[model samples]
Target: MHKYVRMAGFFGLSEPPPIPQSLRNPRGFRPFHFAPDDRIICFYLDFWHVANGDHILHPHALMFTHSSTLSNYAKYLSVVPDGQSRRIPWEAWGPSNARWMEGNFDSSYYSYVHGSRFAYKLPSSYDDTGETQIIRMFDFNPYAVRHSAKVVPAENGEEGTDADGLRAYEEDMTSGITHRDVTSPSVVSAGSFFVDDVHSSLPYREVARAVQYAEDFSILIDEANIILLTEDHTMRVHTM
Candidate 1:
């Protein structure tokens, strides 16, 4: 991770993912499309494990890092293999690179740090002069975890766009593990993903509208309505 940060300070990431026109539902289509906010970064984590009669057993997990680049208005996705310390960006790790290519950790063998979880950094800024910024620290134990960081909208909006604000939106979307079959508790962190209208104090109708097609727990906000989708597959629409 340190090496990648240093490299980012040097060469920096290449082209990022094109900004989408709208927040199309990851599973559906929409007529009115809005381009994605470049300031936001989204991170995703997935884990699955088999259980013995009364004891939990074997676990497998994988994490993906994707964020909107404020500079180029694009998205960069970094795929992380589970239970392993595979350094991202091919150039950082090669034949002689022991730190980056130390191989992934084993699931069965319990450890203090790398158990069966993973996480990645969200973009803070895109200055041409690469100054290092720590996005967030993730402490994941096999059973519990904690995240520490400040989540807020960037103030320098008129300059161009609030890259930090966009990153806030992305972080909100991909904070936890949303299961396909189970409905987990819905949480609305300011910048974390899946914030509903109840906390937002919007009318019920608008909350419904926002969630209708907000894809992957995202909202489309301008001067009108705020659309929100929860991790449990619930949608909420809110009026601005």
Candidate 2:
């Protein structure tokens, strides 16, 4: 056996989530994992624009590698139908996962699951491989996107040294971004995350539509970080 295989045998996980039978061939989606927090968010659609009578609904989905972390990485786990887990070589959601999909779908019109899911990673060691920590995933629903940083703190020494006169005017003043940009964060890459409307009251298609466009949203962690995603027949991520 290879050296890495031997190491995995010593400290490897037991099992991961499995793909649902109906969503197997199509690969419905992967559960989202929020970093610094253990919350998973899942997204899926019940109906499509086609008029085939509900058979056109494709479910299976997964995230792609945008960050350097999963540039050439593999899967780690999979979710089963019965809530059981299994281990896989691919790195869908590993130990670094943080946030995930939750209840956000409703049975309505003008709304549907646009993309797959959004996810993040926490600071973790990749099996003591001495590899640098990083975040990476696949873009689920590709589209146009943009992002902007709401400055909380300015760089050092640039605040305010002296006023018009030759006197110390340290009152914490700097050129603020007074104008709002019309552009939003560009969706660079979609995170390899997926969610199911496992807890919905209406049909799958109805729930998918409502959740896809619903504006009511809650971010996982609120730190000195900013992420923006958009849709234009593709997915993109803005890292600022």
Q: What TM-score fits each model?
A: 0.19, 0.18
Worst 10 residues of 1 by lDDT: 201-210
Candidate 1 per-residue lDDT, tens place, 142-174, comes to 112111122333454322223334322222232
lDDT of 2 by residue, 1-240 (tens): 111111111111111233346665445443452221121223332322233443243222221212223322334332354666655432343322211222222222212121223323322312344443232222222221111222222335333223232321222123111122222222212221222121111101000011122122222211122232223333222231
- Best model per TM-score: 1
lDDT, candidate 1, equals 0.25
Error of 2 at 124 (Å): 39
Model 1 misplacement above 4 A: 1-37, 53-224, 228-240
TM for candidate 2 is 0.18
